[model samples]
Target: AIDTVKSSAATWTEPAQSTTAAATASVDAAASSATDFMENANAAETAAASEAEASALSIGDYITAGKTRSQIQGYGGYTDIGGTILTIESITDQTITFSIVQYSDSGYAADTVSAKQITAQWVKNTAAFEFCDDTLDGKGYGTLSYENGTIHIETRSNTNHPTKLVLNEDLVGT
Candidate 1:
């Protein structure tokens, strides 16, 4: 019994492994992956920006401004957006050239800015193309939706008139 209980208690030292290098490597890899994630996100942002094309205002279509005031007056108040309707003279993949026609100036100093081209960018949404106001200098004037060869204009107005204008048919209904 004495021998079984040995004079000196059996001492055991647990084996251990150094994890410093492994841990450091794992942290470094994670940091690298984070950088890659940021780069990918930036690339996706760029792609989305470049994805905008022109809208569906054909040459000769008429577009009556929702309300000719602030934004519709053109950059630097140079254009009064004169009178009532705008006659689209030409349309490209990125711009709409139009001329104000039909009536006299409403209030602002009369200025019939002819051949005025405005940025008309849009992104395809399934079967419709929605107006891309990303170039509005952080201001959203309204929304334009084009589908089935017709233009649907809706101002983000919370008062008076809402959800207005339909190009082809149902012009009176909207």
Candidate 2:
């Protein structure tokens, strides 16, 4: 009778040991899958934050005060000039006040010009270009887009002609 009892106990314990090992393996696999999911989620979050930062703009990105120079050329009957000095006098929540200094040439003194104000929406960047459609004094209101080292300005308030202007970054500060 004692021998029979010992054999029975051994058979029962063998299956129990196998069941415990299978359960442990299943738990380990679940833990690994969960870790992988968490890692992927973290990577996605980081990419979104980076994209937002890239699209955001600051005041300095538009133009520096007393530090940017714009070469003005007119087309389609608009008044033409050699160059103009650009300075941001004040930037408000909805508008930007500009102090323009016009110059005929290097041999001439800067012309006394009136300050210009334009809506802030015109200076903000959209996609690959920075553009605006706000009024800019006697020159008439138009939509202008700036990209690379060039500006494409179309005067709507004028004769609705497009003008192309090249930016001279070298003369920005001078």
Candidate 3:
């Protein structure tokens, strides 16, 4: 009778031990899977953060004040009017404000003088081009041209003129 009782106990204990071992393995597997998922999520977040920083604009990217006429022409425009960047104020993620002067020759064949307040906005499809929809005198819009290192700001025409203001990075602060 004693031997039979001992044998019964041994059988019961062995099954319980096997069940405990299986449960432990299952728990370990679940924990490892959860850890892997967390690691992957962290990696994705880090990559996204890096991409945003890369897209941020810098001050130098907007405009360089006081560029000479010859230097401006190198970027592909005629320096018919000599101008220097007077000031750069209020820079944002999408806009910048600056001042420029040009020697105009429309009045007397000699270079006439003019100053313009330039507001530039970031355009998505066009990089480095900011459309100036306003003028120094609070005009709603103006004819802005950037060609041959010269930027021309003229009165905004209402005659459905195709002379839209196109901004180029090369024309900024020149």
lDDT of 1 by residue, 1-174 (tens): 776455333321111123666778889999999999999999988877565323333555444434443324343454454333444555556544443322324433343322233335545521122222222212123444455444444323223322221122111111
lDDT of each: 0.40, 0.43, 0.45
Pairs in clash, predicted candidate 2 = 122-132
The digit string of per-residue lDDT tens for model 3 on 1-174 reads: 999999999999999999999999999999999999999999999999887655543233222235554433233364443333334454565665544333232323233222345666634312132223232222224333334333334433234432222222233432
Worst window of 10 by summed lDDT in candidate 3:
125-134
- The lDDT leader among the candidates is 3
Model 1 misplaced stretches (Cα beyond 4 Å): 1-18, 53-95, 98-174
Per-model TM against the reference: 0.26, 0.41, 0.41
Model 3 bad stretches (over 4 Å)? 60-90, 97-119, 123-174
Residue 43 Cα positional deviation in candidate 2, in Å, after optimal superposition: 1.7
Error of 2 at 111 (Å): 12
Question: Per-residue lDDT for 125 in model 3?
Answer: 16
Q: Cα lDDT of model 2 overall? A: 0.43
